[model samples]
Target: MARWEIKNVRIAGVAAAVPRNVVYTTDFDFFTLEEAEVFNNTVGIKQRHIAPEDVCASDLCFAAAEQLLADLKWERESVDVLIFESVTGDYKTPPTSCLLQDRLGFSEDCFSMDIPMGCCGCMYAITTGGNLLSSGNAKRALLLVGDTALRMGSMKDKSRVPLFGDCGTAMALEYNPTASDIVVDFHTYGKGYEALMTPHGGFRRPITKESFEYEDFGNGIVRAPLHTLINGMNVFSFAISKPPRSIETFMADYRIDRERDVDYFLIHQANKMIVDRIVKKLKLPLEKVPYNLEEFGNLGGASIPSLMVTRLRKQLMTEEKSLLMSSFGLGLTWGTMWLRTQPMVVSELVIL
Candidate 1:
C-alpha cells in the first residue's frame, strides 16, 4: 500500500485530442448486426476515434499540449517539467518526452522523461508531477498521457479490437500554496502481468517473422503475438476485486464520503460492463459516474482526463468541486486519488 498526501498542487487546466478517423463496432466484420448490437449494448462502445497510420501518441499529446499552453497563456519556457505516460511510444529508444519537448518548444532545461504504463498512466503521471511541484523542485509541470492502443489490437479479434481508442490528454499542474491536498493510493499485482500484455515486440520476446502470424485463441478471437493479448476473465475478476476494495479503503482511511465529499467519480473507461460492476459494488449513484466510452472507447491512460475534458468540461470550468478518480489495468496496476478543482480552464475536445 503506497499512499501519499501531496499539498499545494493545483490543476490549472486540461485538454484532450483524438484523431478524426472514426471506427464503429458495427463495421467490424467479426460480428453480425445482431451480435454487434448486443456487443455494443454490453460494452457501451458504439464507436472510437483511431489515429491515422502516421499519427502517433506523441503527435496527439503534442497537439493537446500546444492547445493547453495557449489556453492557459503560459510561456512554453515556464513549464519546468514534462512527463509523457503511455504504453506505446513513437520508438523503442530516445524517450518520447524528449521528442515532445523539442516539438513543443519547451526550454532545453525542462526535465522531461517517459513513463510506460497502461490504464494507470494518467494517475501515475499526476502523482509524479504533483510531488515535483509540492517539493518545490518545479513551479509548473505538464503531465501528458495518451495511447495508440487501438493500433495494437487485431482487426480480426472481437474481444479487444472494439474496446480500444487512440487519444492524448494534457493536464497542467502548478504550485499553489492555498490549494487543497491531493491524496493518492497505489497497488500492483505483478503476478497478473501476463493477464493483459503483448507477448512479443519487447526485449524479452523480440519480434520475429513469426510474431505477425495470427492464431486463434478461441471463441472467434484471433490475433498475432505482437498484438495485445487479454485474458478477459482474469482481467474482469481483477478489476472488480481490486479497484473497489482500493477505493473503499482509501475513502475510509481518509474519511471521505463518496456521496458528499466527491462530486463525481471519474473512473478509467475500460468498458461499460466493468464500470457498471464497480459502480454497483461500490453503491455509487450512476448519475455521479460519467462515461465517454461510447464516444471514444478506452483511451488507456488518457481515459479519465479525456472524460474530464469531454464530459465534465462545463462543470470543471464553471464551479468548484471535488473529484475522485480511479484507474486500473495493464501491468496489473491500480490506483485511486481524491482532489478538488476550482473552475479551471478545460478546453473543448480537439479532433485531428
Candidate 2:
C-alpha cells in the first residue's frame, strides 16, 4: 500500500540494447522438440538474446545510454543524476552506477547510485529518478535497467533457462515544470522471497565449493546453488495473483479509467501465460497490453522499457499518451506507475 505521486518530471526518451546471440528454446539440448514446443505454448517464449560470456549488464546498458543520449543530443555534463537498476551488476563491491558514471562521462557533480532488483527494478528506478527531479535536486536523470539473467541459470534447467533473456535499457527523465504528476504504487511479500532467488553467493550464504556442485532438482531440472532457483508453481501463483491486484489498486487509487484514461499497459515480460492471466484478471482489452515475449523472452527489469522501444516506439514518438506500467519478480516485489508521455525520441534497438 505504498503509494505516492511525484510531479515536474517527464520522460524525454528511451532506448534498449540486446546481445546479438540468438537462442531458440527448441535448440536447447536439454528439452526434446516436443517438450520445447509444449513449453513455448505454455510459457510463451520462443527465443531469447543471450549475452556472450564476456558481456555484462553494464555493457549492454552503456550501449543503450549512449544511443539515447545521442538521440536526445543532451550534453553528458547536463545529466544531473544517474540510477542503475539490476540484480546483475559488473562487480559485487563498487556500485555499478559509479562505473557507468565514469564511462558515460557525466559531470562530477552528478548523483549516482545502484539499485539491485529484478523484474521490478525499472519501475523502482523511474520512481526514484522522478522524485529527484520533482524535488528540484536534479535537472535531468538517466534511469538504466538491465540484466544478464540468462547467465545466472543452468543451461539444463528447463524451469528457468528458456524463460530469461539478456537486455539493457535507458530511460531519460528531465525536470519539466509543466509535466503532470506521476503516480506510483509499490507492494512487497517478503515471505515469498525464496520463490525466486539464487540460494548462494550472498552474505548470509557465501559462495563455497559446494555452491557450484550441480544436483538434480527433479523434472529434468538440475542446478547448483549458484544458479538461479525458481519454484515454478509458487512463482506462477504469485504472478497470476499479485500483478492484477496491484494494477487494480493503482488504477483505483489514482482514479484512472482503463478504457478512457490509459493508453497502454506495459507489463513485465515474465511470460505469455502470466501476462495473459493478468490481462484477463483485470478484464483489460487485449489491444491495450503490448508484448514482445515472442522475440525477446523475459529481460527482467529491462522488459518494460525495452518493450516500449521495440513494440510501441511509433506511438511513443508520434502521439501523447497515458501509460501504466507494472513489474513483478525477485524479492517478491511488485509495483505500478502511471505517467503521461509526450511525443519523444525513441531509438531503435541496439544489438551489441
TM-score of 2: 0.98
Q: How many residue pairs clash in model 2?
A: 0
Model 1 C-alpha lDDT versus the unseen true structure: 0.92
Error of 2 at 75 (Å): 0.3
Evaluated at residue 263, the lDDT of candidate 2 is 94
TM-score of 1: 0.98
What is candidate 2's CA lDDT for residue 312?
96
Task: Residues 73-135, candidate 1: write the lDDT tens digits.
Answer: 999999999999998898899999999999998999999989998899999998999999997
Query: Which RMSD values do the candidates have, in order?
Result: 0.9, 0.9
Residue 29 of model 1, lDDT score: 88
Q: Model 2: per-residue lDDT, tens digit, 158-211?
A: 788899899999999999998988889899999999999989999999999999
Provide TM-scores for the models. Answer: 0.98, 0.98
